[model samples]
Target: MGNHDELICAFLLSGDKPGRELSWQEVQDWTPDQGNIWVHFDCTHPGTGDWLRAESSIAPYVLEGLLADETRPRCDSYDEGALIILRGVNLNPDARPEDMVSIRVWADSSRVITTRLRRLMAVDDIRNQMPTGKGPATPGQFLAKLAGRLIDRMGPVIDTLSDQTSELEEALIGSEEESNLEDMRHKLNELRRVAIALRRYISPQKEALRRLNHLDEDWMEEEVQGPMLEVVDRITRINEELEEIRERASVIQDELANRLAQRMGGTMYLLTLVATIIMPLSFVTGLLGINVGGIPGSENPWAFAIVCAMMAAVGIGMFMLFKKMKWLTIPK
Candidate 1:
C-alpha cells in the first residue's frame, strides 16, 4: 500500500507486480499507458480539489460531485465513466452506526478515483487485498469489491437493531411494573429513529447499485455485474430488516404508553374518591367554626366531643356507601 498520509492511497495494477503503490509524485506523473490505477483520497486535503480539476482533468460536474459537502445515494453515467455515491454505516469510534458515511466514486476503463470525507474501512479492505492477486483487476471489479465491503459491514449493525427490538418486546411482555415503562418507551423510540435513518440510505443505495449494474458503460464488465447485483440484493434486504425493526418498535412503544395511561388513570380514580369523601366533612367543620353567637354547639361543654364523633360517623358512612356501589374498586 502507498503512504496513506501522503497520497491517501494510490495503486497501479499491472501484470508484473499485480498491484503497486504509487507516491504523490508518481501519481502526478501517471498516465493511461502506465497502467490502470486506483486512487483513494481524503477529500479534506487542501490540494485534492485543485489536483482533480487541473492535473487530473476531471470534468466540472464530476469534480463537483467528488468534492461536494453533502450527497445522497445516487448514480450517474456519461460516455466515459460512471459516478456513484453510496453510504455505509458509521463504525468510527464514538459514532452512532446509523449516521452513515458516504463514498464518492468515479470509474472508467483506465482509472478509478474514490473520495471520502470520513474514513471508510471498506477502502482499507480493498487495499488489503491488493497484495494478493485476488484484488480488483478492472474498474468494474473495484466498484464491486468496494460496494460488497460497505454492504457487508452493514450486516452486523442491522442484526443488532433486530436483536434490540426483540429484547424490548420481550421485556414489555413479561413486565408487570409501570415504573420503568417510561424509560423503556424512550429506548424504543431511539431504536425506531436509528432504523429509519439506516433504511433511508440503504433503500436508495440499493437502487443506485441496481442502476449502475444496468448501465451500458463498457467499464462495467459482465463478470462484475454479478457482484454488483449481489450488493443491490443485500442492501435491499437490509432495508427490509430495518423497516421490520421500526414496526416492532412502534408496537412496543404503543403498549408501553397504554400501560402508563392505565396506571395514571387508576391513581386519579383513587384521588377523586378521597376528595369526594372529604367534601361534606370539610363543609361541616367550616360551618361550625364560624364565630356567630347563634352557633348551636358553642354553648355546650361536650359539644367538641359530639362534633368529632358525628364527623367520624359521616366519613365511615361515606366509605361504606362507596364500597356498596363498587365506586372505590379498581376495574380490570
Candidate 2:
C-alpha cells in the first residue's frame, strides 16, 4: 500500500460498526451497505470513480512527484469538489533559502482527499490533531480542520516576513551598502511570488467554502458548519494580509532600486566632472611632449613648474564653478 504507484484510501464506517481500512480489491468486492462510508484510492486510474474521484495523476503523491520543484501556489475546483492549492512558507529566522511547499486538497460533504508532492507544515499540523480513537464523521469536517491548520501555520510565516522587511527598511535608511539593497530585492521578490501563489488558491477557496455553506447535500452536518465557516473567515483574513504584504514588498523594492540608481548617478557625475577638468591639462602635457624641436615648454626647466601651477589653478577654478552651479550634493 506504501508503494510509489499504489493508491490507499480508507473508509470509516458509520453507526457502531468497527472502522476498517480496505484495499482497492476489498472495496470492489464488498456489497454496498447503508451507514458505510467508502474511501478509495486508485493508483492507475483516479478518474474512474463515482460520487468522488481523484486521478492518480492529480493525486497528491503523483502531483508532488511531478511538481516537486514547482514553487507556485494555486487553487482550483473540479466536478468532484474543490481543489485548494497553496505554498507554505519556511519561517526560519536565519537567512536561508525560501522554500515553499505546495498543498492540494479535494473536499466535499462526505470526504476530503488531499494530495501533495512534499510534506508541508499545514498538513502535518492537522494530522497531529486527528483523534487516535475516531476519524472525522464527514469529509467537510476534515477539510475544515485542514484549513484551520493552514491558517494557523501561516501566522508565523507572515510574521517572519514582516519582520525581515522592516529590518531591511531600517538598513536602507542608514547604509549606502549595495549588498543590503540586493538582499532586500531578493527577499521582496520571493515574498511577492509566494503571495501571488497564495492568492491563486486562497481567493478561490473562499468562494468554494461559501458554496459549501449553501450546498444542498444532507451529508454536511450542523456540527461541521460552524468550523467550516470559521475556516473560511480565517482564510479570507490571511488572504488580505498576504495582499498587504505584497503591496509593501513592491513599494520597498521600488524605493531600493531608485536609491541605488541615484547613488550610481551621483558617482558617475563626479567621475565626469573630474574628466572634464583633466582634459585641458592632458592636452597641455601632450602638446609639450611632442617630438618637434619648437615645443613651447621643452626648452625651459622652469616651464614644467609653471605648467604644473597652471593645471592646479585650472582644477581649483573648475571645482569652484561646479560648487556654484550646485552640482555636488552633501552625503546624507
Clashes of each: 0, 4
Q: Taking the tens digit of each residue's C-alpha lDDT, what string does model 1 give over 212-322? A: 889897868899888888888888888788888878887887888889888889989988999999999999999988877899868789999999999999999999999
The Cα local distance difference test for each model comes to 0.85, 0.60
Model 1: which residue pairs collide? none
Q: Which candidate should be chosen as best, given TM-score against the real structure?
A: 1
| lDDT (tens digit, per residue) of candidate 2 on 185-232 | 787777777667566656665675666555544555677789878877
Quick one: RMSD of model 1? 2.1
Off by over 4 Å in 1: 1-6, 14-18
Worst 10 residues of 2 by lDDT: 48-57
What lDDT is reached at residue 331 by model 2? 38
Candidate topping lDDT? 1
- Could you list the CA RMSD of all candidates, in the order they appear? 2.1, 5.8
